[model samples]
Target: MLQSFYLILCILGFVLPYSQFVPFLLEHGLDIKLFFEQLFANRISGFFGMDVAVSSLVLWTFVFWEGTRLKMRYLWVYVVCNLLVGVSFGLPLFLLIRQRQVEQQTD
Candidate 1:
């Protein structure tokens, strides 16, 4: 049940953000300056952007520390997911994988 939830979240995470971003990409064609300008265009957006930035750093740290402790391979997968999507995809994906590994160890 939990894994299913995480999988759903992963799909939603990838889809929802790209839903917004893909159109931007289509219209702008990799406008980095415009992207940042719009991202921090207002106080609320800036707040969210900063928060996500900090959260991504924290997520990366957690992925490294906990994943290494559990001896999980392919730690890069989560990071790549994060880079491609966002923390929404990466964190739950990591949690789902971690849960399976824990269950395996107990079994």
Candidate 2:
């Protein structure tokens, strides 16, 4: 289900930071300073923006999923915590999960 998908995505997120991409960069003798500068100057904004979007989606999905199992009070707390997690990790998946739950209720 969505939960499983979320977990898998989280695992991938963790793995990506140290995966072949980093090794490939290192192998190419890329300069860390220049590379970082380029990343920040040209890519970090877009990259992190995507991260935020994705995190929001996942978070809202999780919230909605959890709402199905619990009372509103608990669900609200769950949503707040999920939002905090998303903010901390720059991921929107959790927020997205919650938004889905709200949409379900309204439907």
Candidate 3:
């Protein structure tokens, strides 16, 4: 349940900014290249891409864990694949968010 909520939140973080704010900026005549360069230099793209990746991982992890718990042997392959995807794309974002949550709770 908590994992699901986190996954949704992470996805929203990515979608909202891109779909809402990015389009608004573009409609207002923002230069695409300059916008991208600024975004890249400040690491915003990396941050948001990581957010999406981590959310995907969290969602898949929950799925695989549940499948395994249910004795679904066929899902082992899926688990491996999901883990690979997560590590390739989601690990950094996962770590970042996990660390943030830990810090917030500790504080």
Best-matching candidate per TM-score: 1
Per-prediction backbone clash count: 0, 29, 0
User: lDDT by residue for model 1 over 2-100, one digit each (tens)?
Assistant: 889988988888889999999999999999999999999999999999999999999999999999999999999999999888998899999999989
- Give the residue spans of candidate 1 off by over 4 A: none
lDDT of each: 0.93, 0.54, 0.53
TM-score of 1: 0.96
Q: Please list all clashing residue pairs in model 1, or write none if there are none.
A: none
lDDT of 2 by residue, 31-105 (tens): 767545554675766597577668667666655666556333454554464443433332334434554566677
Candidate 3 Cα errors over 4 Å, as ranges: 1-42, 79-107
How many Å off is the CA of 98 in candidate 3? Answer: 27
Error of 2 at 5 (Å): 24
Candidate order by lDDT, decreasing, is 1, 2, 3
Over 4 Å off in model 2, which ranges? Answer: 1-41, 74-86, 89-107
lDDT of 1 at 33: 100
Count of backbone collisions in candidate 3: 0
lDDT against true structure, model 3: 0.53
Query: How far is 21's C-alpha from truth in model 2 (Å)?
Result: 30
